[model samples]
Target chain A: MTGSPPAPASLPGDDLLNRIRALRDSPAATDTGLGRELGAVADPLLLHEAGRLLKGVAAARLTRAPATRATTLRVAVAATFTADDVVPLLRAALLAGGVDAELHLCPYDQLGVQLTDPASALAEFAPEVTLCLMDAGALLPRDWDPSALDGVRTAVRDRVDAHTAAAAGFAARTGSAVLLHTVPLPRPDRRSVISFRGGAALGRIWREANIALLAAGETRDGVYTVDLEALFADEPGPVRDERQYRFGRMAWTPAAQLAYAREAAAFCRAVSGLGRKVLVLDLDNTLWGGVLGDDGPAGIELGTVYPGDCYTDLQRRALALRRQGVLLAVCSKNERALVEETLAGHPDMVLRPDDFVAVVADWQRKDLHVAALAEELALGLDAFVFADDSPFECGMVAGSLPQVDVVALDGDPACHSTRLLEPARFAQLGVTATDAERTALYRGRRERHRLSTTHETAEEYLRALGIHVTVGPADAYTLPRLVQLEQRTNQFNMTGRAHGEALTRRLAGDPGHLVLAVEVTDRFGGEGVVGGVWLDRGPDRWTVRNLVLSCRVLGRGVERAVLQYVADTARAAGAAVLEARFRPTARNAPAATLYPSAGLTRAEGPAGDDETVRHEARLDRLPTLTPDWITLVAKEAPAHV
Target chain B: MSDTMTTLRPLVARVSHHPAESLAPDTRFTALGSWGSLAAMRLLAAVEQTYGVQLDLRAYMKLETVGELASEISTRLSGGAETHAG
Candidate 1:
C-alpha cells in the first residue's frame, strides 16, 4: 500500500484539518507514515490542526506493523494550574518522540495532595512517568520574612524539601520515575524602594531552592529535575501570558508550553533508554576547521581564534560526551597519516586518537565505514549518531544508513557546537561509574583481541587472561549499570525487558526475588557490571525472570559462569529445580541455545504455541564442569534482601 | 494611516476559518458561528504575538464585532483611552 500523501505547505487551516482527517480515516494510513506526515509540518497552526484531527483517530483502529514496537506510556501531570491545553501538546510531543502517550492530568491546585496521598489517582494510574509542573508563586509561602534574607532562604529550603519528599514518596509507591520542575525565578518588580536588594535576595533564595531540588533529585533514584527556570529564561517567545493566567490559571503561554513539551518528550525518551549511543564524527572541517589534505596540520583553522575557537569548542563538547562514556568513532575520507599527524600534533585538538574506539580514515564511503564500525564494536546501527560538517556526507550516511542519526552541520562554524548539543542525541537520565569507565572498558577489548590473536586456541586465550567474576545482589553502586544493561543489551537478553531503576531496586529488595549483578575483571582491566540476572525464588523451584549480558562481554564463557552460579545458589537455597525461559527476538538469536547448552532440558511445547522455550535444570544433577580460566567470587546477599 | 481593521481582519479571518475577503468590518464574531472560546484565545495570542499589544480581558469580553475589535486594538496600540463597550 502507498503512503499517505504529504499535506501541502500553503493549505488553509480548514483544508489542512480536512486533509488530516482524511488521513486518519483512511485504512491504509499507517501510524508511522501518519506520524511522519504530521511531524514534517513546520508551521505550528498546521501541526496543531493535524494534532486535533489525529486525537479523533480511534486507538484500536490505528494499525501498525508487527515489527514496529509501540510503547504505551501512562504519564501523570500534577501541576498548580490548568493543563487542559498543555496535556494535548505534551501528548503530541510524545507521539512525535515515537511513543503513544496516555496522559492523566491531575486536578488544578491538588498537585500537593494528589502527589502525597497514597489513594490519589496518581497511585491508581501507576504512570510510567509523573511530571510535577509547579510555579514559584504556588510553592513559596506568601508571608515569609522579606527583610531577613537568611530566614527567607531557610523557609524556601524547607518548602523545597517538603515538596521533594512528597515527590520521592509518590515515586517509591508507584515505581514511576518522577520528573520535577525547578520553579522559575520571579520577574523583578521595579516599584520597590530597595528593588535591587529585594531582587537579589529573591534570586538568592530561588537559586538555593533550585540547588536543593537538584540534590534531592540525585539522592532518590529515577527522580530527574527539569530546569524549567532555565527553559523559561532561554525561550525566545512569550513565557508568561497574564490574560490566560487570570482566566484559566495557566502559568505559561502556549508557545512556551510547546517548547516545554518538546523538552519533556526528550527527557522521557532518555529515561526509556532510547537515546543514541555512539557518535561517529568526521575529521577535517567537521572536527577541526579546513580540509586536512590541502591545509595540512599547521594550516588548519584551530586554536584560540575566531573560526578556529569554534572548532575547538566543538571538540571540547565532543570530548565531554566521550568522558560521559559515549563511544566516539572517526569516519573520514582522508589520508590516514595526515589525520593521525593532525590528531597527534595539533596543539588545539581536544580529542586524541586514543579517544576513538574505531578509526576509519581510509577512502571508503562514510556509510560503509559506519556499518563496519558498528560491526567492529558489536553495537546496533540504531545506536550510532553520525555527525559531520559536510552536508553531502551527512546526507549520504542518513540516506543509506537510516538507523544512524545524522547531525548535519551547515552555516557558520560558531553554531556547530550549539547545533550538535541542541538535538540532545545522547541525552541519558543518569550517569554511572560504569558509564564513565566505558571508554577504558572498550580499550580493554582491544587488549583481549590482541591476546586472542596471539593464543593458539580460545581456551588458551581465556586461561591466560586471568578472568574474575564477582556475583552479588544488586546494590546502590551496581543498580545504574544493571539498569543500563537491561536497557541496551539486545543480543544476550533472555526476556528483552528494559527494567528501569525503580523496578530493579524493588526486585533486589524483595525476599522472593534474586537480582544478581555480575562484575567481570580480566588481567587487562575491570569491565564493571557486565551482566545481570533477575530470578524468582520459589519454595522448591527457581524461575529465571531475566538474564542479560552486555554484548561487549559475550563469547567469554562468562554467561556459562553466571548460569552455573545461579544454579548453585538456588540449589543451596532449597531449590530442587532451576528453570529458564528464552523469548527469542530478532536481535537475541545468540541467546537461543544458551540454556540448552548450559545442560537445561527443553520442555516440549504444544503446537502453534508461543515461541518462548522453557528449559529446566534439575538441581540434584547439576553440571559440575567449572572452567578453570575464571575464578568465581560470590558475595553474601544483602541482609535487607 | 490605515486603521487597525487592515491588520485585524486577516487574523480574525484566520481564526474564524473564513476568507479575509468574506469578512466585513461589522461582522460579528457570534454571527460567524465559529468563534468558540478556543478560537477567541487563539486570536488573542496571535494578536498579542504579532502586534505586541496585550488586550485587556475586560475589553476583550465586551468586544462584539470585527469593527469593535479593530477599534480596541487601535486604542491599545496607540496608547489611547480605554473603551468599555458594555
Candidate 2:
C-alpha cells in the first residue's frame, strides 16, 4: 500500500543493503537503483535507516537516472526545524519518481529569512521550486485558551501572513514556484484541552489557519501545495515525535515525514512534467473474472457475483481516472465482434464502447497495438501504461517497449485498482478545465516512434547475417537445443504444447513420431538447433504435431524448406495427405497463417472456438522451396542412435 | 556488553563517525572529536527510534559516556513514558 501503515515494519532488506554497499562514490553515476528500492519503503524506521546509510552521499552526487532526461531542477527547502534529516529521504523519493532534483536546504529555522533576504543562500541558489514547510507547533500559541478564539486566530494569522508574504515576494523576485503544505495541528495543543467546547474551538481555529495559508500561497503566481491535512485524514498516524520535537524541534513523525516526502516528490514530478497519459487496459480476467473466449460474453463473471464485483470495482475506478482526463484505451486479443458485443450488452460493465479512446481487439501482438495507439494519438510510448492480467503480455511489452510502464493485473481482482494507480503513474499537481482544452500540449513532445515501421524494418538489420540453414534428426547433440525451442517458441509454433525435456526424449524413440532439428548459422556464429518439427505418422495422413521455429531465425525466410522437407518425407513414405492443427489463440495468429502461406488451406467446415482448425494439403501438390538467400543442408540421425 | 549497549553503540558510531568497536562503554560522547550539537541531535533521534525511548535532551546531554546513554535507554525501556513511540 502507498499509504503508511500499521504496516509490518522491519529493517531495510539485505538486497537494498547490498546495493547501498556496492554504490560507488562517483559523482557522475546516478543513484536510480537506490531510489527504486527506497521508493517501495513506507515504514518510517526503515526509511530512516536507509537515509542513515545514505547519509554521507551529497544530494548533488546522486542525480536521478539520465534515462528520463528530465532537466535538473534547483529546489530550495525552507523549514521551521533542522531540515538536514529530510534531504536524503526527499532525494531518494524524488529520484524514485524519476525527477532529477538538485536540492538546497535553507538555513535551519529561517523560513522567513530565506524567503525575504535577497542575499540569503536560498536566494543565491536561484531555485526553480522552493519547498516551504511549517510546523503547527511553531505557529500556534502554547497557551490557547478555549475562551480566546479571536486572540488565537489573530496570532495565527499574524505568524502565517509574515511567511506567506515573504514566499510571494520570493516567487515574484525569481519566478520560482513555491510549494507549501497545510501544517498539521500539534497533538499537545489538541489534547491540551479535552472538553467539547475547547476541542471545537481549536479544531475550528486550526482549520481556519490552514485555509488562510492555502488562500495566500496557492492563488499567488507560481505556488502549489501538497495537502498534508487531507493526507492525514486518509492515513492518520502520529504526526510528531514529541521527544525529537522537545530536543531539536523536529516535529514530524516517521510516517508523516515519509508521506510529506513522497507528496513533495510528486510535486517535483508535476513540476518536471513527467506523467503517464494513456492507460492501455487488457480484457479477460482484468475486466471480468474468466477468459472471455472460454466463458463467452454472457457467461463471463461481471457485476452480479463474488469475484465479478471486483471487476466492477476496477471498472468504476478506471472511469474515475478518465474523469481526471487520463485517456483510456483497450488492447486485447479476441474476435473484435465479440468484444464489441460484450461492451454494448453486458449488464454489469461500468465502462462502455464510447469510454475508450480506441479499442484494438484483434489477433495481432498487443505491443504493436499499443505503439500504434500512441502514434495515432501523437504521443510518446513513455506516456502510455499497458496493464494486463497475463504475465506473457506484460513481459512482452516490458521487454520490447521499455519506455511504456507495464502493470500486471494478476492475483486478486480486488487489489487491481490500487496496484494500477498506486505508482502515481499519472501524477499531476491538479487538473483544470484549461488542461482539457490543451490536448495539443501533449502532441507537442517529439521523442516518439512511428511504430508502424519499427517491425517492418527490424529484419533489415538481419540482411547482413549471410544466413545458412541445416535440418537434422533430433539426437543427443541437438536434443537440448530442440527441447529449449519447443518450450519457448511461440509466434512460429503450430501448437503451444510447451514440451519439456522428458517428453521430447520419450517422443524421440516412439517411431510413430518423427522429430527434425533445424539449426541456423549466420556470418556472426551458429545459432545452434534453433528450430524443430515434430510429426505423427498415421495410415491415412501424416499429422505435423508441432512445427516450431526460434525467433532468432524467424526473419531469415528458411521456414519454406522446413515445411517442404516434412511434406516430401511424408509423401515419399506413401502418405497421401499432410495436415496440422491451427488454433487461433490470440498469440498463435502468426503461426495460423504459416501453412496457408506455403500452399495449405483450411480443411472444410467452420472451426469451433474451443476446437482446433485443421489445415491440410495433398502430398502431391507440394510447392515449398528454400529462398536463394539461404543454403539448406539436411542431415539424418544414425539408425536407432 | 548489555543488549542496550549492543544496540546503542552502532547508532552512536553512525552519528560520531567512529567505528562501533572502537567506542567502548566508557567512551565519553563529548570526548569524541566529531561530537557536536548536530551529531548529538542525530544520535538522540536515532536513539529514540531504536529504543522506543523518549529521553530529555538536557538530561541526555549531561551524561558523559556511551555507557551512561545505554543505561538511560535501559531505564526508559523498563519504565517512564513522557512520549514513547507507539
Candidate 3:
C-alpha cells in the first residue's frame, strides 16, 4: 500500500525548529536511508521540516512494485588499463541497479587483434551489450613503424569490412541489435597519427563499416556506434568539474556513479522501442513557477527566484532538446488566456508558446489530451510522459495511461532546483548542433500551423508555405541530427526506432541499407532535419521500413517529399519498384491515406487493421512532383556511419 | 483487473493533493500539487500517475503500519476538513 502525508504549514525559523522537535517526538517519525545520507543531527530533520511548507495528501493504499526486472543483458568489456579498470566498477554499479551481465574482460593488444576476434567470445557468451573501455594509450602508438602502421591500418579496414558482412549476415539470420562503443582515446602522444587525423580515424573506421554493409544488400541490420565526447560535453558544471566528482582518489566518484547510472537508464530508454521517439515535459512549476491564472503574466515569478530559477533552467534544457531535432510537446493545464499572455508578453518567460511542437492546455482530461495530441501530431503515446506539479495529476496520468511516463514534482521550493535537474529523466539519446535551435524552430512551426489555419483552404495554405525538402543519403554533417531525430521524434514516425552513433558506420560498411534524412524549410524558418528514412536497398527493388517525420512539419506535403525522394533514389539505383509498407499503430493512422494518396497500388495483405500493408509503385511512371507545395532537393549526403 | 482499478479511485483521491470530492477516477493529478520532481521520482511516474498514488516510501520505512496509515487516512477523510495530507 502507498502512504504519504501532506506537507505541513510553513513556520518561521524558530517555530520550524520547534516543530521539528515535536515531529521528532511524534510516533510517525522513523529513520530511513535519506536521514543517514544527511547527518544524524538536523539536516535530515531540516528536509522534513522544509516539507511542512508544501503540504501533501496522505495515501494509504498506494503500493508500488519496485522495479525487479533483472537486467539480463550480458556485456563484454574491451579497453586500455585506465578504462578497463573502471569496467568492474561500472559492472558492479549496473548489477546493483538490476542489470544482469557476465563481464568478459579483455586487455589492450596491439593492432586491435582482440577486438576483431572478440566476436568468438561474444558469440560463445551471446552477450547482450558490449562496452569498449578505450584508454588514451589505445589511441597513441608507442613505436612508429611506418610499414607496420600501413599494414595494420589496411588490416583494420579489411577486418571491419569482413566483420560487417558477417554481422549483417548474422543479423539477417538472427534479429539482434549490435552496438559499438567508440571512445575517443585522449591523444597524449603525437605518434598515434596515421593517414587520417587521429580523431578522424575512429570516424573513418565507423563509416567504412557502414559502407560495407550498405553495399552488401542484405536487410540484416544491427550495428551502432557511441560518441563519448558529446556525452561528457554540455553537462552541468558540478557534474563536469572533475574535482567535485573526483571523490578523493577515484576518477569516477559516487556522484559520477549516479551520473553513469542515469546514462545507462537513458541508453536503455532511447533504445527501448524499435527506436527512440517522444519527449514529455512537466508544466507549471517545471516550465514556470506559480499557476498561470493566479500569478498572472507579471506575478508568476520566473528567471531568478530560487524556485523560478530552477524552472528557467529546466526550460533551457527543454530548448536544447529541440535543437537536436527532438519533437517537443506539452502536457500542462492553465487558463488558456493566462498561459498565452505569459508565453507572449512576459519578459522572463524563457519558454515561449513556440517551443512546444504540440501542447494540451485547458482543463481537459490529461489522458484524453495526450491521446489527442498524439493523434493530431501522428505520434505514439507510449513514449509520452505527463510532467506536472501536482502528485494527484501525475498519479491520475500514470494510472489512466500506463504506457506514458509521468514525472511528479516535490513541492519543496528549496530542493526544487536540483530535484528538477535530475539527469535520470531528461537525458537525450543523442545531441547535435541542430538540437540547440529546436525550441525556436518549434515556435516557427507553431506559427506556420496557426497561419495555416487562418487560410480558408488547408491545401492552399500548405501550397503557399513553399516547403522545400532536401532528402539524401546520411553524411557526416547531417549524421548527428539524423540519429538524434530517430531518437527524439515520436509522432508521425511509422516505426519508432533509435540507433547509436555507430549507425552511420554500420550503414556505410554494407551496401544493403539505404539511410536518408530529410531537411524541410518553408517561408517561416528552416525546420532542420525534419525527418528520417531507413530502408533496404535491393538490386531489383527498394523496401522502406522506417519513415518518420517531425510533427512540426506535418500536413505541409512533407510525406509527399519522402515518397518522392525514395522513388527518385530507387530509380537512380536501378530499382523498378519502391515498396512502402504501412504499419498501423495507435498514432500512425495519419499515414493510412499516404500510399493510396501517393498513387501506389495497395496489394491485399493479412487482413487485420494492425497488420502491415504492402504498397508498390513503379519508378517509371510516378506522381508528378508538385513544385509549389514541396520541392525535393538532394543535399550532399554524409558518409555512411 | 477491475477491482485493482476499482479501489484506485479512492486511493488516488486520498493520496492526491487535490480534493477527494471533486477528483474522479480519471481526474488529472496536476490539479493539486505543483508538478515537481519529488513526486515523479518517488512514484516512478510510469504506472501510478493515474491512481494519484506513489510508492509509499513512508510505509516502506516502517514509520507507520499499513493498517495504521489506512485508518489515519480514513479518519481524516471522514472527519478532518483541514488541508492535511492525512
- Sort by DockQ, top down from the best: 1, 2, 3
lDDT tens digits, residues A397-511, model 1?
Answer: 9778756767877789899998888656687888889877777777777667767879999999899999998898988788778987787676788866566777788889888
In model 2, which residue pairs have backbone atoms overlapping below 3 Å? none
iRMSD, all candidates: 11.6, 11.4, 14.8
Model 1 chain A weakest lDDT span, ten residues long: A60-69
TM-score on alpha carbons, each prediction: 0.84, 0.64, 0.49
lDDT for residue A240 in candidate 1, whole number 0-100? 63
- CA error at residue B64 for candidate 2, angstroms: 4.5
For model 2, residues B6-74, the per-residue Cα lDDT tens digits are 767667765675666677778998789867765676677668767767787668889999988988888
Docking class of 2: incorrect
lDDT of 2 by residue, A68-96 (tens): 43236677889987666677678767756
Stronger candidate by TM-score (1 vs 3): 1
Q: How far in Å is the alpha carbon of A505 misplaced in model 1?
A: 2.9
